[model samples]
Target: MNLGTYLTRSARYWPDETVLVCGERTWSYRQLDCRTNQLAAALIGRGLRPGDAVASLAWNRGELVETEFALYKAGLMRAPVNARLGRGEITHILRYAPVRVLVFDAAHREDALAAIAAAGTDCLPVPLDDVPGDDVPGDDAPSDEIPAAGPVGVPYADLLAEGTGDPVAVEVDEDEPCVLNFTSGSTGALKAAVQTFGNRLANMRKQLMSDESRPRPGTRYLACGPITHATGMGLLAGVFGGSTTHVLPAWSPEAFLETVEKERITATFLVPAMLTMVLAHPGAADRDLSSLTSLRIGGAPIAPQRLREAVALFGPIVAQGYGLGETTSVVAGLTGQDIARAVTEDPELLQSCGRAAYDTEIRVVDEAGRELGPREVGEVIVRGPDCVREYWQEPELSAETFKDGWVHTGDLAWMREDGYLFLVDRKKDMIISGGFNIYCTEVEAALYEHPAVREACVVGVPDERWGEAVKAVVVTHEGRAVTPGELIEFCAGRLDRYKKPRSVEFVPELPHNRNGKLDRKAVREPYWADAARRVN
Candidate 1:
């Protein structure tokens, strides 16, 4: 079945139910269904054929949601660019994906134009200022000139208005390409993970079956991060269950809390960094967040102690998930109940990302592909319907990462006797000091336990005697003071002396990548510049 059918099904089952809420605008199932149909017909009318690539560079908005459904209906491949990406990365994706139509939010007009010029492609540019049922953003008075069709791009409203407003009936096989999900190019060049229609369907099923963060009727799932990332993976699940998906146009700790209270948001997804910020926000304690039932955090490994703190502040409703872009949404998840158990009973389980999700098989394998036993740390590998088959066009990388029908997640972890998976650190990020392996995540988690530390990132620096020395970069909480010696002493209590950071550098804030994960590569780049080899 076409994934787009989920939206149509919701419209038929509950026509008046709200499926989307962006800012002041709300979209009912019926309205969203018809608009997407119109959009599909309109894109077809503009000479786009099935299998053509359509790229969208926009923030979280009603139009972006409509366009995704339209792509599924039209059988076009979706290439969603991160709005924060610079012209260079944007151009690379544009040319590599060979997008036939490029759509952008008015806010990104300049960047889109520049990328288009750089890529030198014949891609059509469409700037969306307003869509049907969308509120115009401006002062009490009217806004400035709205650009239409000439050098800039065509207005989305004009295209939608010209279409027949009927559903575009197209045959899309379940295995057909659906989304070209781009990986965060933190380690190297950007690559697109080719997610198929069947893979997405599997994602929907996994999300629905999950106990902790499942979406149900009237479930209000709020997304503070850009929906183009992991946060947007829940869109189809929302439609399937007759739930409403709320999007924050911008992100701020105070603003996010305000939305949860104002909208009575029942569930939401945030990266660990965002979770830290929200908990530290002055207004977080004062906000009325009792309505939130599921607080799902992912995109990075959060400190177990920090997760316990979040549960304390937000009730026992915090859930943690672990997955990569290659594995659609989440293949393993720590349920809210699991979190509650960790806080009250088994604090050790807090480090595990729960058991494998429904229908997903997880394995820890050594270098020779032999599965390891309990408490034995090795590379984590997973296989399931939700996992991607290959990277978009990179055959070599596809073979390397997707070996033997399994997606070899470079994360080093070990499974417990009871089947819980405990992540150590990224294989490449593991540091060896004096022949002792030290996981950076372990160190960071220790730093988070200190009350004065707001955020922490640990890396290995070049050293003579130790070969590679453990170094820590930290961001302390506001109005809190802590010295390097104090933080090192704190780590000494939780970890081995060799694993403790030999030196610590305090900064006002840590750098986060476009996807909100701490930019460890960026933080470590300067230190390695003068070294002959990054690793000792």
Candidate 2:
């Protein structure tokens, strides 16, 4: 069955229910279903064939959501480009995927055009604001910066209006490629995870079955981040469960709190960094946050102390999920109740990303591909219907990552006797100083225990004596101060002396990637620039 059928069923059952909300504007199930059909019809009429690549370059907006469903209905692959990515990166992705149609927002007009020109691809450009028909009310006119569209470019509205309103029931294979989710380029080049239609449906099932994070009828899911990424993964299940997905046009801590109160947001997802900012915001506690039922944190490793603080403020509703682009959505999750138990009986469990999600198999394996025992650190691998079977257009890389039907997550972790998975660090992020392996996350977690430390990222730096020395870059809490020696002493008391940061660099703020996770690679580059190699 097509994933688009979920929206059609929702429309039939609850046509007047608002399924999408952006600011004061809202789109009912009927409106969204009808618009998607029209848009899909328009794309098909414009020569879009099954398996054609349809790319979207935009932020959190109603049109982006509509575009996703329309593409699903049309049986085309959806490739969403991160709006913050550079033109060179965008060009590489476009040339690699070889997109046939590019749908972009007015804000990304210049970048999209420049990337297309640089790539020299003959892709048809469609302005999202002009997608034919009045799918959204008061959608401001296209910005003057948008180029005049001749035959090569078509107004989005014109195309939608020309299409039929009847539902598009394109026969699509369940295993056909549905979405091409690109990994963050923090490590190196971006690679797309080839997620099939069945994989997406599996994602929905996993979320719906998980009692803690499941979406309920009339539940409002507030998505503060870009919906095209991790936040968007919940959209299908939220709709399937008759939930409303509220999108933020832009993100601000104050705006997010206000939206939660106004919309009575029942559930929401945010990266650990965003949660840190929100907790530190002066008005955060003052807001009426009682409506929030599930506050999920992921996209980065969060300090246990920070998790405790979030639980204190948000009550026991705090949950943490862990997954990758290759794994569609979260394959491991810690529920709010699990958090409460950890806080009371087993505080160590708070450090875990929770057990394998329902129907998923999680394994911690050594270099020889042998499953490691409890407390033994090794590569974390997962297998299930939600896990992508391959990477798009990269057979060699695919074989290496997807071996024996398990997706090698490239993450280092250990599983407890009780099945909880505790992340140590990324394999590439591990530091070897003086022939001793030190996970940067362990050092960073200790730094966060200090009340003065707001955020910290630990990396390995060059050293003559130790080869590679442990270094810490940190942001102090407001109106607080902590010197390098003091922090080193602090970590020394809590951790092994070798694991302590030899030096600490204080910054007003730490760098984060597009997904709001700490950008450790960016921090390590400058220090290792003159070194012979990154490792000792």
Candidate 3:
């Protein structure tokens, strides 16, 4: 059955219950079900087929949630481009994925248009605005039926109205690609994790079964981060379990606290950075956050100290999980009780990211893929139904990552005898700052574009608010002359704002190995010398 069958079931069970809330707007289970059915029908009407891709570029909103389910019903791949990514990266994603329809809001109007032009694809733009619906694009695109359109393409409302308000029961194989999860690779190239329909079904099962992330009836889940990423993972589970999902249009500490109090949000997920900000917010103490039952944290390795501080402020509701894009759902989790135990009896457990969750099998392995004994540090590999089997269009990378039926997550960690995972270092050439993955080579490529930058090494430095901050060490060309601010701005223009270096340092010389290759580890050593763990 399609994943959207759950939504239809929910609407039948609780049609009048609020299923989604975004600011002043609220969507009941009936509204969401019918609207998603209509949207799914509309996309199919426009000639989109199962396995064909549809990408969305917008901030967190009810429509993104709607689009997710609609795509599920249509059996289309939901390719959600990160709203924070720059124009170039956006173009790279547009070109990389087989995206046939690009849905975006006004905030990203110029960038979306420019990316389409640069990508040179026949992707029809579906703007989320009430523009005049005439002379739409894609009228001749081999379809028996076409929706009413505007100058750019079909306006979002017009497209929805164009949809027949009937359930679209498109049959699809479980192995079909469901989502194109795009990420910047260490090679400075963009790649997408092809999350299969089976992977998503397994994900839903995990969420429904896991104690840490399970949504309960009458519970409201506040998404405190971008819905395109981790925070949005809970939407389907919320609907399945009859929970109302409250979306934060834009995340702020004040907004988060207020929403929880106003909506009485029972469960939510936040990255370490958002948790840090909320903990440090002055009004946090004044807010009535007693309604929150689960405040699950993930996206990056959160400091044990922050976990304790949060428990003191928010009671014993703090939890943690560890997973990645390749793993559609968290394979390991630290529950609230475990955190409470860590605070009281087991201090060491606080440093661990729980044990293997549900059916997921996590192992610490040597270079030869041999499973290491307890307390032995090695690469972490995972095998589970929810894990992705391939990268979109990259067989070599797929072979390297998804080998022998296990996804080799490039995180070096050890497993306790009891199965808790303690991440010690990152084996990949990447950094996680504020929960966003930034590869060193990806940033270095941007810095190299500057005329004065002879050599550049990007690393993550210890940060208070963010788990880690992007730092750049540069060796300038002789007499070329460039200020740190200028170099930083240059990268900001070329890359995403979050991926740009927070601080830049000039060095006369950079460390190199005997083979004459730049020693990235040596450049990272100084910044992490005082730290306890290699990764934050």
Candidate 4:
């Protein structure tokens, strides 16, 4: 079975309905389907085999979306390198996958050429012009503007123009690799979670089945982050549900607000950092966002206070999910109603990421693989159809992370009696002070309660007496101010004496990984630079 078949079916059902929108370009179901078929045929006709690797290195655009479906139709492995990656990292990915073709936007052309040269591979480049109205034969009387060309590589439009517009059908096994899901390398060298066709199919199904954030007819899904990563995962379900996808070329608060207001977007996804920016944007109060139905946040844990602010501004439409690249879909979700209920009835539920989602099995396990009971913090492990079993080519590393049938997430969390997962901190990020354990998230949660604090990152610093002490790096709202001593005192009231931050430092901003999660590893580096061991 192939996933592209679903798109073919959607086109049959909603031929004239808009399926994709990026910038000023909009592709109807029929147009997108025909163009993808042409793309698939072009690739296969150009000597690409079923299992050959194809990569896209670009910012959010219609071309990347087209490439994703085209690869599925052609039975090729989709390796999407984050556009924010450096030249060296890009080279590593191209050489590691040895991608036969690299499709990129004009913005990344120079870096793409350098990576190809450095990798010393026969990787052909496909330059996408991103001409807003360029179209296939049956699309809008055919664009008079030709597909843009560069000094090296094929023109993206030329390949589409060559297609017969007939469907490109390929036989593919469900368990075969479909995507090389790479991490942002916040912890170390980038690693890919090899997700299979079956894994992604299940991911699509999980979203469709759940009542939490299911896409339905007339659903307008707006992706505010890079379509190559987490926010883009929702596209699969949206496509299957015949929803129109709106892709933001880049993220800015004004752009997001304007698009949502203009398109009357029903659903959208944002990472915590993006949400923080949106909540802080001055004009957000004036935007006509009443049409919004779902505001899903992920890619990082958001402070509950920030979540509350989101609900206040967005009218209780805010929700969140917990998952990673290894888990191809959300393993758990905190629904909008759940957040609302927390505000009224169950205040503590705001701290929870919600119960195990759908068919996923989650456990907080000890070192011996024994499941811990309620309130017992341990490693969070998940097993399900959506959970990936291995990395692309790193067997040893794969074995270390994936054991038995469970993906051992290094996150430290505990389960409540009702099965909700409450993450304390990442195992590595937890600070041990004089044999007393301190979860950075717990301390940060306290700091977020202060009215002046806007963003906070907690880390461990070396201390002669306690071995390690908790340090809080904070960013306050632009017009708000709070002294370090006052903030420390505020936290002292909410947390245990041992759990309270020993010191606080005000900063203009906190470092965020390309995926938009707070970069805790970067925040801790300076404090641990002179330590005998990075982690005490």
> All candidates' TM-scores?
0.95, 0.95, 0.79, 0.95
TM-score of 1: 0.95
lDDT of 2: 0.87
Task: Give the poorly placed runs of model 2, Cα more than 4 Å off.
Answer: 130-152, 184-187
Model 2, position 387: C-alpha lDDT score: 93
Model 3, residue 351: distance off in Å is: 0.6
lDDT of 1: 0.86
lDDT of 1 by residue, 197-262 (tens): 899999999998876677878699998888877989999888898989998887879879999999
Q: Candidate 2: how large is its RMSD?
A: 3.5
Deviation of model 1 at 130, angstroms:
6.3
lDDT of 4 by residue, 433-504 (tens): 999999988888888889899899999899888988989999999889788889888988998888888899
Residue-level lDDT of model 3, residues 1-536, one tens digit each, is: 69899899999999999999887789999999999999999999989998689999877778999999999889899999877677888888889888999998866766777788889998988888632221223211122232333377787999999898798778899999998888667765778998998998899888999765688778888987778777888888888999899988877799899889988988998876577668768789999999988999887666566787789999999999999999996989999999999999998888788988899999999999899999887899999999999999999999999998999999888899888998765676567887876766557767866767666778888887787888999987678999889988998997898889999999988875321235667787788788766673
**lDDT: worst 10-residue window of model 3:** 133-142
lDDT of each: 0.86, 0.87, 0.83, 0.87
| Counted clashes in each candidate structure | 0, 7, 0, 0
Clashing pairs in model 2, backbone N/Cα/C closer than 3 A:
130-156, 130-157, 131-156, 131-157, 132-156, 132-157, 132-158
